[model samples]
Target: MADLTGSDLTAAKAQDDVAAPPSAPRRGGAAGLVRWDTAVGALLAVLLLCSFGFVGDFGNTLNLSFLIGNTLPMAVIALPMTMLVAAGEIDLSVGSVAGLSGAVMGSLWNAGMAIETIIPLCLLLGLVCGLVNGLLVTRLGLPSLAVTIGTMAAYRGIAQIVLGANSVTDFPQQYLDFGSGRIPGTFLPYAAIPWAVLAVIAVLVLHATGVGRSLFAVGASAEAAWFAGIRVKRLRLSMFAATGVVSALTGVFWVLHYASARYDNATGLELSVIAAVLLGGVDFDGGKGTLGGAIGGVFLLGTLENTMSLVDVSAQSQTVVTGVLLVVSVLGPRAGRQLARTVARRRSAGSGSAPAATG
Candidate 1:
């Protein structure tokens, strides 16, 4: 009878253990901001609803199309910039790279080179520009921020040299139409189709692949990632290159969309991209962000700017608004995290102080 009783107790214990769920990962630092990302999405939805009701013609098709079209240049660049930041790096030169690519497109067109040939060459230039930035940072062990700042100036100067105050406005009508047209009876710009495809590719790469895991790992701790056999430098280099290539592509699109190519295209685009990424809850320090959140941030800013424009807000006031949001993005998460920790501590203390149940 005793042996049977012991066996029964042991079996019950084993069953209870098996029934327990596995422990979930504790949120830490920026990693805890996953909830924050969702909050931004919700806020964006609310803002859109309010705008449609309060702002005149904001719901109309033409205004909506302009909003998406103007926002796209920054939005597309934000995609790769998110990944680069995820891996704990940034490329300020992206705007200049866009400008340089456009300048080259203009120069080649002026030389009577076929548009087809010039495009491929422009893409190749992007790869080369990216490689140069990657090499400087990876090979020389320089800080990426400093290196990119230098390159930003150099690239823009080269753009000036290439196009020399001239703009190229003539391109094949078909290509121009693709850049600036919209689908019938919808708010979707034709350029948005390609951007949507790229967004999907980016989402898959960041959220569902080994490469994505490695980026978070590196951003969280470069030394640890290296110890775990990740090719840290190689990965960083590739990310820089990706930023370059995408920015270059955006430049080409910029030229066609505006029907002109010049040295100064997308001059301050990096600011918008970085601002949107951070506002999306991507930790500026790295190791935490979602592409979904980043994209949400993009549209939020775009919408706000569009509404402001419709309301006759001065350009300087809009700049101030963006600056204020930038400040909030940096501080909001840290404050929320602190408040959460305090609440958790209070709960723990209250539970500990509770009296035991009567026997």
Candidate 2:
């Protein structure tokens, strides 16, 4: 009887142990645990609904088409930028690299290079630009922010020098069509095809692969990732290069879509891209973002801009709106995290007081 009773007690303990789940890590507090992507997604949906419902002619196919097509370039750049931020770095020079690529293409075309040849050369130039940024940061141990900032000015200046107040029209019609054409019954442009493809690729790479996991690890702690055998420098370098290439491609699309190329093409584009990425809930500090969230961010801004344009909002006011949205994006998560910490501290104090009272 004694033995059976002991066995029963052991069994009960084992059952309780089995039933209890492990606690989740509270690294960044409640906000960290809360998926910002879902929130951003909901926000996007509401914004879209409001636009379609309230804005005059905003729901018309032609207007919708133009909105999507115009914004496609920014959307495309946001993909690699998402990964770049996920890995805990940024490339401010993307806009300038894009502008430079466009300038180079225009110059090459005028200098008797075929459009086909000019395209590849432009892509290569973009890759080189990326490599420079990556190498300078990784090798010289410079802060990416500063390095990219300097490069941004340098690249944009080069672009201005190359094209110098000149514009290029007369791109091939078929290519132009690819930029401006839309799918039947949809506002999505054919230029969005590459964006869609890259977005899928980015999703898989960021969320699925071992390499993707390494990016998170590196972003969280570079030293730890290095100890774990991840090549943090190589990964970052590759990402920078990828961003450069994609931005250059966006430049090409920009030229074709607008039927013109100028040195100022894609000016101030970097801000919009960064804003969308952060708004999607990708932490500026890095290692905690999703491609889906970033996409939601892109569409949310695009929708907001389109609606505002339809309402005849002033350009200055639109800029202010974007700035406000970016500030909110950064602050919202931080506020949540702070609240979580405060709650945790209060709970700890209460628990401590309860023990003393019992004593």
Which candidate comes out best when scored by lDDT?
A: 1
Q: Model 1 scores what on Cα lDDT?
A: 0.88
lDDT for model 2 comes to: 0.87
Candidate whose TM-score is highest? 2
The estimated TM-scores of all candidates read 0.87, 0.90
RMSD of each: 7.4, 6.9
Off by over 4 Å in 1: 1-34, 342-359
Prediction 1 TM-score vs. true: 0.87
- lDDT tens digits, residues 102-214, model 2? 99989998888899999999999999999999999898989999999999999999999999999998788898888788887887788777778888998999999998999
Which ten contiguous residues of candidate 1 have the minimum total lDDT? 19-28
Distance from true position, residue 176, model 2, in Å? 1.2
Residue 120 shift from truth in candidate 1, angstroms: 1.4
Instruction: Provide backbone clash counts, one per model.
Output: 0, 0
